[model samples]
Target: MADSTSQPPRKLAPPRFIPPALSETAYPALKTGSGFVSRNVTVRAWGGDEKLSDTQRVQASGLAGCISGTTGGLMRGPRNILPGAFVFTLGGILGQLGLNKYLRHQAQQPAPGPQEPLTERILSSKWSPFSRLSDEKYIEIMEEKILRAEADIALIDDRISDLRLKIQERDQRASTDINK
Candidate 1:
């Protein structure tokens, strides 16, 4: 048998002599938006730079609202133009403001505690259905299951034995016929 305690073989080192042009072309050093120097280039976020003032963000949100409102107004007949634009624009602004507030609040709040293991959580929770059962009751249920499984296995074994006997009889009959 092979020795399980033996150390694994070391990985081979890459060749030192990479062409300068190939190296520069393949792995050019690029600065990320977060100001980290990395070998791979990253795509910029939508609307170019990350530094947007509150006014700019609000304006962009308002512009989006206007576009959505105009689209909605167009969808509803020309008769409902004024009403659609007014309602949709107001709704969009309110929705955007609510979303921004929610995001800010979420950001301000402390992160949640480390999660409990599923089994531990289930056993500990008072609301869990299984939590109502005592350890002794659980053990009793498991024991009943084991007994049922053993009974099933016994039945399967008996059936297998019967099948083996039938197979043996079939072989014997076939052999006798061949001899004749």
Candidate 2:
């Protein structure tokens, strides 16, 4: 009998539609002329090289429609609502533009290769705004600042005590002159 374990496992067929999560590859073979039309038809039609599945395209279309409808509704309101409407429309447009830019940037980034430890990834990521100083270094910096502040407070207290002493001496001299 043939040994099943000795034979290499067969490869599975590629899915008809690549999942949206997996479509962020360097080169994706997208469907060229899918007749499916929707609100985001313009964007989808022009995205010749980006592989977007039918569901994703539809979702994008729905989102675009919602934004357009909300903006249009706001624009048609009374004069009192004009300012609010303008702000709403402007914010919506800016948000959509920002989202597009972010998506494009993310797509351009290379996919993760071998898995690294979570701590290592977080420490190395450029997105973090915090300094990556060692614990000891951070403690030393804080201690130096605290010591400097304490010294300044001590100097101020000493100056205040000297002023109080001078005021007392002046009062005693005035009293002696008045008694004389």
Candidate 3:
């Protein structure tokens, strides 16, 4: 007979990511001309830099759009059409562009030419920026970036929750507004 107290161990695979909630007060802030675009860019850029596949990146982008639209739909004009899906698409595009910029920056670095100093010579230097930080520094910097991204993601979730509450409050007020 199988042991009643001991259960089969669950498998642990890749990490599951949950995005942050949108805030209600943020709706006006998000809907502002450049504010919305900047928010989308920030979210999508973080997604691109992380381990997410292209499909997942696309999904993140879409969610960003939906968050904006749904949060404001109640008070927005009929022509104030903000779509979650469309905004997500745009966000993804912007992320790709940012990624391309990084790639191009790397490619532009010159290869070791004959005129360049040899490894030993460069090592002997006392004032080189390259020598100041070792490979460990790069890893540390990367870790800091991941932490910031995680915080931003958490913010997104909080915003989303706030947005929901705002929607409910708005709904409650709508009847009075119409009657007035």
Candidate 4:
């Protein structure tokens, strides 16, 4: 019997936001504008590449976003400036959300191990419709699969035998009762 003290397997939590990789880029225009502003305005404003911190980056991005958004809005219509301010704010929030989700995903991912030369060679093989495994490795994989199939067949046979035994016992009892 299983131990009563053993805990149930813990389930992983559903992610709070969709992973950045799966989702569409949130506000492409904002991103392009922010980048342009960062490259032009922020660089000039802050005296160019002093190795900014994360806070600084966000601040610069916000400033750049505001400048670009305001300019775009102003160019579109004089009346749009007020609405553009609100949109700029919303865009900043959404950009932050996207960045945060991306960072979390990066943090959660396991660091990949260095690839073995043989494995790398096999993966890089140019041969179409054919595996690049060595003859021994191919044989080993097939043997492993055959062993697994044999084990599954053994378990199924055992179940069938058990069921047949139960049926025979039931039949014998019924026959005996009828005779009696």
Candidate 5:
């Protein structure tokens, strides 16, 4: 049997519904579509697509450079901003071109052979003072340097001897003149 103190269950209210009216939805859809179109147009104008040729890639890089320079100049405030932008734009183009050239050069170089011994690898590394120079080559280079130094020293000695002879001749003439 139910307890006499029990109360009846209460019913909850249903959720409110908002209708999708064209006036409310159309503006946002149009805004989003326009933004999408604008982005695509800007990217196309900048040659930013992946299928671009080398010339196109360079042009895109130049555009990127120009944008970067303009932003940098703006960040620095009003003084000489135009000049700064021009300088940075030029720098960016030249720097990117140089980087591309270096990368192409590196790509064209032959790949290294199979794994080398640890000692050989370490010795041949760019950080090593003896990079690419074998013991025989190092010795040959040192010998050449030594020969050059010796020749220079010989020339210096000859000059000193000639100066000494001139001094002796001058002193003898001075003494004879004094004795006269």
Candidate 6:
């Protein structure tokens, strides 16, 4: 007894391939295959069957900083888009607190590690960032940044006052409608 059975071909899903990392091997300097041509070549191209360049390694290292985000075929490097990347975050914060603008820029580009606390960065002598300024001129610029900061704070306060007025009007309208 022969049991006739036929299974239709299963629709094959399209393949999605992720590129594997390149191999790691150092290509040493070796003489070319030309029997006695007295020529010294100190450099050679590093493509195909050779090692990756230092730049490629550095870029790969930067990507490792964001490994958790690369699962499901997505690529979002951590350093590329940090959490608090708002350009003027420090400015807005100091403005809210009525701080000086000189302090804001100074705080932003502090002298220490590229991203360190303001006080620490300023005090680290080894990371001094004074090259961009002259002592006499720096004093004058500081005054200007502080004055601008004060003006910005005043403007924000005025805006807040106007918002308060609008809120009061909306409240009054709601009260009148409830009474009716």
Q: What would the per-residue lDDT of candidate 4 be over residues 9-36, giving only the tens digit for each residue?
A: 9999544233455335634554465557
Candidate 4 error regions (>4 Å): 1-35, 43-50, 104-110, 115-130, 133-180
Clashing pairs in 6: none
Error of 1 at 112 (Å): 1.9
Going through the candidates in the order shown, the clash numbers are 0, 0, 14, 0, 0, 0
Model 1 — TM-score against the truth? 0.43
Candidate 3 lDDT, tens digit per residue, 92-176? 5577557667776877998766764576567667765455357899899999999999999999999999999999999989978
Best by lDDT: 4
- Candidate 3 has what TM-score? 0.27
lDDT of each: 0.59, 0.58, 0.62, 0.69, 0.66, 0.44
- Model 1 global lDDT (CA atoms, 0 to 1): 0.59
Scored against the true structure, residue 81 in model 6 reaches a CA lDDT of 36
Best by TM-score: 1
Kindly report which residue stretches of model 5 are placed more than 4 angstroms away from their true locations once superposed: 1-50, 117-120, 123-180
The parts of candidate 1 lying over 4 Å away from their true place are: 1-50, 117-123, 132-180
| Ten contiguous residues minimizing lDDT sum, candidate 3 | 14-23
Q: In model 4, what is the error at residue 180, expressed in angstroms?
A: 90
| Positional deviation of residue 165's Cα in model 3 after best superposition, in angstroms | 97
Candidate 5 residue 29 C-alpha distance from true site, Å: 34
Residue 99 CA displacement from its true place in model 2, Å:
18
For lDDT, candidate 5 versus 6, the one ahead is: 5
lDDT of 6 by residue, 1-180 (tens): 544696667998444233333211211111111101111111122342135444433333233322212221122233423432232233233333343445457779847745867666566656776434569899999999999999999999999999999999999999999999
All candidates in order of TM-score, best leading: 1, 4, 5, 2, 6, 3
Better of 2 and 4 by lDDT: 4
lDDT of 1 by residue, 1-180 (tens): 779998889998544334556655432221111112110111123343355544454445555455555544444446555665566557656765777788789989999999988998988888887665779999999999999999999999999999999999999999999999
Give the TM-score of each candidate. Answer: 0.43, 0.34, 0.27, 0.40, 0.37, 0.28
